[model samples]
Target: MIDLTSIYHRAADNYCYLFDEETLHIRIRTKRDNVLEIVLLYGDQYEIVDHQWITSLQPLEKIGSDSLFDYWQVAIKAEHKRIRYGFILKNTEQEMTLTEKGFFSFIPEDSGFFFCFPYMHKSDVFSSPDWVQQTIWYQIFPERFRNGDPLLNPAHTVEWGQEEPSLTNFFGGDFQGIIDSLDYLQDLGINGIYLTPIFLANSNHKYDTIDYFTIDPQFGNINLLKKLVEECHNRGIRVMLDAVFNHCSVEFLPFQDVLDKGEKSLYKDWFHIHKFPLKDGDTINYETFGFYEYMPKLNTANEEVKQYLLKAAAYWIAECQIDGWRLDVANEIDHQFWRDFRTTVKAIKPDLFILGEVWHDSVSWLRGDQFDSVMNYPFLHKSLQFFSYDIISAHQFTEDLTTILHSYSDNINQVLFNILGSHDTPRVLNECRFRKERVRLLFTFLFTFPGTPCIYYGDEIGLDGGNDPGCRKCMPWQEEQQDLELKDYIKTLISIRKETSLLTSKGTLYFLPAVNNCLAYYKQKDNQVVFVLINNSDTEIDYVLPFSLSGKKINLLLTQQEYAAESDELSVTLAPYESNILSFYI
Candidate 1:
């Protein structure tokens, strides 16, 4: 058997409370070279008898592996919220039982030998807002969305949709524009709007924040924001504003003070400065987000900075009654500040959502104390690889998705900010090489899959662009320029999503086997099931439903067609780039 002496630690990230007070999530790590399967034996601590242990066995899944170790995980629901658990690990050579005491050849007779979770408290459970599951989010890059109030427009603003966007250009999209578009958004059936940074900043994107307390004049003031929030709430839409706390613009007051006063500045500790004289040359004297010298990284570890940002967070929620915050470059900041931020914001509004922008695995910030969820960039990457690039097969896509699903607990997976396109990336339509049919298939998969789905602005109407300045195009207001069919299709999908509970975050997802280049999955919640099928290839294919689904009445949600399965293997033909969302009673 492999040596188990080096493995240890059952702390926060390794073991966590998931879903509710009764559920516990645990992870174990072993040397990377070992090929071992682990089974957990767990039961109530009080259930042990004399020299006999009454326990249940659960096999752990190997969720992830890196260069140094393999990580195994499992989630167990203890009825009493107290658990005594031990691992039974086996390799090709021998098997051993591991507990708090040590590894042994047989199970320990005493309950004290097992590892114990004292109690899973309700307050410690990781949960997002209840309203999140029901939300279909729309991401808006304000500078390009619309120019409702031209008086608030920037001096050099160009004609809407006439000129291509540049790094310095602004098209005058503001809060009033969003207020004016509330009817359009309501008609589109989305209940959540995620607006990129609206705080005072130097650039058009507002990512390099100048002042957190004030809204940019180009985007309107606090009054406009309040009115926009009220209007959105009136239309049954929740608003989430972007928080750019990781860095600040060079022109920011504090940063300007630091530049003027150097080491003598009282605000010197707010930023990370490397030298006595702050220089603006290509070789940066201070630490920055990237190579850009203007966007200096904030010292989130500083106590004063922490309180300042936390207060700003509390101000937005308490004053405007916003529903959530989408943290920008969240991974670079220290986790402690985020914990404080969460406490500060949730104290004002307990259910306010906190979403972090993390591109990779965010297990560290996703505990009960910090962020509620993170941007699902991995989902976008895998989906694009399969649908846009056509590099990976359907089976590989399913396997990749399964790995992502297993990486986090079901609770975190449910509220993940799943997005196909955003301001930073190329438009989804452009990624698909302008293939409307491919875009339709991707949309079908996005809506039917588990998690809260988000659409970037202008995506529903088939806006096409490349990266950065290209993706940030002016939203076309003219109906003749819009793809009404695509918009209507997206609206239909949203309507179906809102009406179907199984398509929401509460549903349990399962991947069904299908032919090459064809992907299929089923989501089930209680008695209702939603089966989704997508054909990514250029040729037609026949898909056979599992034997368990035979003799059931299936209702196609989009086409409004009904069919009755006749045999154990129900066959359906899908043309190239065609997709389907079928609902049935089980």
Candidate 2:
């Protein structure tokens, strides 16, 4: 019997949204494999025939299926830019019509029974910067990328890559260091650089920001920061600075004033204080960033605090000409504050990328009024679980990924900030137990996957470390210490991704069935169809592709080798941990 409750559809939000100004994507979900077919009953709500509404029928194609549901999508164009739609679903045992009002046994000609899209409002579309989809980002922790100017080394700064990374250690990596390393990043084929906090602060990491206006003296002055952005821009690299608005250091002037004057201070509302007269005891009296005594959470709801932070957000873009912002602890802040922040920043530069640091589901923040995208930690966890830890099978991993893909509109998914590792997590190499081959497969999948991909500063060189302070290791500048082969492999992937529109947001990239513990997916754009097959298991596997490549020209992207498909079904033999990207045209 059909699961009547499982059939789902809405004419707005993630289920239905604008792909572009002219195209609207409407989606419906049903019990997995239950519905034999979905017929879209759609027409402009105002269009009528003899005092009754007239509609057209279009069959919806199944775009994806996860464990519990089948997802179907159809892009529609309404002649009057308005639509009334409903689904006619047929199962093996029964057929039903679903509308906004209720289920029906027969088609409803009245517009009142259908889901309504009043108008195609341009503002409703979730639009990010166009260039963000193609961007390959590199995240740099300013204290450890390189030591270009030894003159600016902080007191007690250790020699580069000397001691193991620690919470308190500083290796004197400054903006000039990054400026000097532009050629290296350029060679790696990265177009965007996400630099962690460089603001004046007492700690080595600078996450506890003391002054948002000034660049840390240890890093560089404002002029040098400008020069770094200028230098990066010259090399066709975009620069995005970290903005830590959720909390700030105790040493920040406003916080200091509140500390000294308590209830009498004019800036007492700058931070969340419980019953004044702050204490240093274990039981602190104020809200902070996850119980950290030094980082007091800001009172974003306070009017003065809101304007103060919003001004600082505008300052960098207006002054340094930066390309984006990566908000720290973004989920903790009030939504209206971010809404205002978006309006303020985008007014200055419409193309600026605004990415939020959200570890969990973030559909609430990805609307056009807020962030352009979020740090896709779900993608990180799943990738590490499959490739690094070998805990999940390829079949299970693909099911998990498909669920996430259907949760957001394609526009939001394409601009997502997909990260493998970061300052807060273990290095990808460390997660893979230093297996170079596992890292290779992981990198291959990341570059081939949709959304904007980011590389942690030293990930290219096979840097290995555990979480937090350990993950913040110094970048090895010496050629002998670097993993040259891994770097080249990642570089090649970036180059191929830039050249192939199939890998970008232009086309579809979905998983094929998992076979013999191997993962496979294809990217199809027009006559060009591309497949990426990876042998996840340790043992060599003779994998069979789901689609036939008979009588077509096939080209392996990584190796540029050409082949002619002799049979309809293609059988590919892959060694342990080996992956290949094969492409063919009709």
Candidate 3:
């Protein structure tokens, strides 16, 4: 008789299997102190009876306080379908592969089992009909925005001299500030605001979440968030909060309970632990990548933890009525957790915008299961690498850009989030060595290029900063008196981007050969066509159009400059940092 239920469990170094009395449920159990590692299920036995053992990574040292973990899950519904799988572990000198004699086998190449988690239904989600298909988004870090509320200033605990220039430190900035600055953001022509983590966090940056249910008091109360949402909606702006699900603060109730109770904590199952790091009842395990022990990582592998955070996210969406989320450090967490997390958030708020923070290509996330978008760090990194690193050749630079865009699947490519500068990096102006022209050329490319464009606060006014605290500097309201031209130029770019469908539309492109160091590309969408050219070289170079010219020619919408295209190739020139956009009607 083929059993209908089966489970495969792997301990710190062993495997356990369990079968239901009715043979309809298979249970796999493995425990370390108080934590459980893997619990998987199978619908039928005959479906996947013959399978070999594969590979598995050595269990990570319990970074939190618990020893339990659930890395992946498999659920088969059909009665006769069988899937083979196994586990292989290798670290340094010791390597071993083992097969369990229970239910369906785990296979590394099989993606079907990986996508088993629940997903937000398409209809209920808030994605535009073609949201990800054709989108150019702009991200706004709220605190540095306009200060709308004088009541919501951050309380300074440490002096500037005492404050370590590290991410662990916090600077007070809030939601009221975002509302007061809507006009400034609107001037930049962004469709959405992917604000950083705004949940009730203990720190100023808000990554160390204290309470998922409430908005941070420093950032303003929940009421302030509602007002911001209403105002943003009033102006056709979509708002997405930052979701830092990978961990919680040490002050969080679950983690606190673990610390208080030691080994007998009821919430001990919520974290991963091999052996308690505490020697004399002192909390030894601080967190994943933290200098201090206060910020603890949440065990996403736990179902209750998953459900709790998902519900918290849903509550905010329903109560506050925000659009979606920007997941923090998405790559470090388990893929299944995000899959289920995405499903839960979408189920609560369809059309919800989900973006992830990954420093490189996240195509694996876009496989129709996890995130709607990811911070286009890959593009941002490459662009900065080209200008700041100067190690890459022009050919290599262009090729890298092309490769990134081409790498994404169709659906993922549409909602790609690109940025010039963000809260985490040096402002683009400084990254370009304070050269206004190179900056201008970059702006031309940024606004013209595909994917959503995110502008870190103060980038428009040419704010200069090197890294973290510097990047998070106060807005240059006072300096605008001297840099009005740069401000106006950004406003113009925003205006043109909003008005032109060709610039915003999603379509294929043809790269025109470089004129000297000038590179150009044509963005065509049906009857609308736009030609963008940027000259980064020291001297002006004449550029000739490569496409057919049998059409009505017009001036560039942003600069209001006109050019005639008589032959298939037309002569156009750009000076240092000079860029132009020529529109044509076919």
Candidate 4:
């Protein structure tokens, strides 16, 4: 008997989203091992022939399965640019039709009972810059990356990389520093750079923006920034600046006017002030970023505020020719503001990448109108829990990973801001408990997994630090102080990924049955297949491929060695914490 409770589908959101202006993708979930197949019956609700609705039939392919459910998806298009769809699912015993209303013994003739996709408007299509999917990103914290020009350093500036980092101190990292290291970044195969907030601010971290129109004096002036961007563009590198529009430093002139004049201030409505006289004892008069008093949240709904911020957004892109913007606290601001933000920025440069700094499930923000993609924290959580803390088994890790993949559509997944660590979080090495083997294993997955991957400034050199203040350590410049071996290893991985298109968004991903503390997966693009296997256990284990590899030519990607499979079943051995990538033709 088919389990009715196991079936699930939705007409909108990730379950159904536009792949392009003309193509639409629909997905469904069923209980694991309970359903044998799913066939889709779809048609335009209005068109009819011979007193019957015109219809089309197609089979849904099984894309992935978790511990409890299997995911199936199909892409389709309606001649009328709209569709009403239903499913016919089969089991060992019987088959039944599933519509939006309920299950039936036969396919519903009335379109009212089916799921409806109103229209596929060209404007509704979820589109983003295509170049982002192919680029590898590196993130740099300006205050700590390097000190290229000591002339502008604060009088209290300290020696580079000699002491611990603090919230208040400065080290004079600037645009010249990044410009000076463009060759090094190019040498490491990085084509995109994400710089934290660099606007004029009072704090060393620069998250509290005092002015949106000017670059921080300590970092560099407009000329130096334009020069840095020009140099990066010459090297095929893209630049992304952080937008702190969610809040501004308490020192902002408008907020200061509000503070001094209270109810009588002309800019009193610019902020979310609750009561006059600013604050009453412990009660704050206005909202702020978290509980901190220095960072006051802006009323994004205000017309003047929205236009002012949008102008700033377009100015930097036009002036510096920057390629992207990472919006901070994007979810907290009004959705309408972001919709306007997208329209404003895209007008100047249609291909500008707009990324949101959301940390949770961000499906609502990725509907093509608001954001292209958000920071993928779920990936970081699952990876660290499995590899760093050993809180989950390899089997559980694969299930969770598949769940993450199913959480969004393929288009959004391709350009996700996938990072293991950023300036706000603990360094990847610290998360792995200072174990180099585990760190190496984690990074292997980072670069190999789907989506555009990012490396923190000092991560490739084995930088270790704890959370915030600690995670923001200065970048080391001395050759002897860096980990050359690890750097070379990361560089090679980037090179291999760039060389093989299948490893990027060009290939399709599927998780294999994990066995004996070994996790396995593969990507296939046409006849080319690249298989990845990793052993999490201490002792060596033999893993057998689920599908036969009979008479196939396999070339190991880590080391370009060729081998032939002698039998139908190919069993390979993996050493402790070892990972290998194999490429072959089907």
Best by TM-score: 2
Model 4: per-residue Cα lDDT over 1-586, one tens digit each: 9888988999988789888888899999999989999999999998898899988899999998888899999999778899999999998898999999999988879988999899998887777798887789999999899899999797789888777888888888888899999989999999999999999999988899999999999998999999989999999999999999999999999999888887898888778887777778887878999989899899999998999899999999999999999999999999999999999999999999999999999998998888988989899999999999999998899999988898988888877888889988999999988888888888788888988899999999988889899999999888787888889888878987898888776334898877877889998877878888888879897888765678999888876688888888888788998888888887
Summing lDDT over every window of 10 consecutive residues in candidate 1, give the lowest-scoring window.
8-17
Clashing pairs in 1: none
Candidate 3 structure lDDT: 0.62
Q: Report clashes for each candidate as comma-separated counts.
A: 0, 0, 32, 0
For all candidates in order, the CA lDDT equals: 0.86, 0.89, 0.62, 0.89
Name the regions of candidate 3 deviating beyond 4 angstroms.
Answer: 1-138, 157-172, 277-283, 290-292, 479-482, 526-528, 563-568
lDDT of each residue in 354-407, candidate 1, tens digit only: 999999999889878899999999999999999999898887787788768756
lDDT value for model 4: 0.89
What is candidate 2's lDDT per residue for 1-586, written digit by digit as tens? 7788888887777898888887889999999989999989999988887898889999998888888998998889888889889998997788889999989999887898889888888888889888898899999999999888989999999999899988898899998889989989999999999999999999988989999898899998999999999999988899999999999999999999988899999998888888866886667788899989999999999999999999999999999999999999999999999999999999999999999999999988986889999999999999999998889999899988998888888888888888889999999999999999999999998988878999999999988899889999999988898999999999989998988777885554678789877998887777778789989888888777766679878788888788898988888888989988887776
TM-score of 3: 0.73
Determine which window of 10 residues in candidate 3 has minimal summed lDDT.
Answer: 12-21
Model 3 lDDT per residue over 245-353, tens place:
8877877888888878878988887866545643346556544535456666777888899898888878988898988788888887889998898888878877887
**Model 3 clash number:** 32
Ranking by lDDT: 2, 4, 1, 3
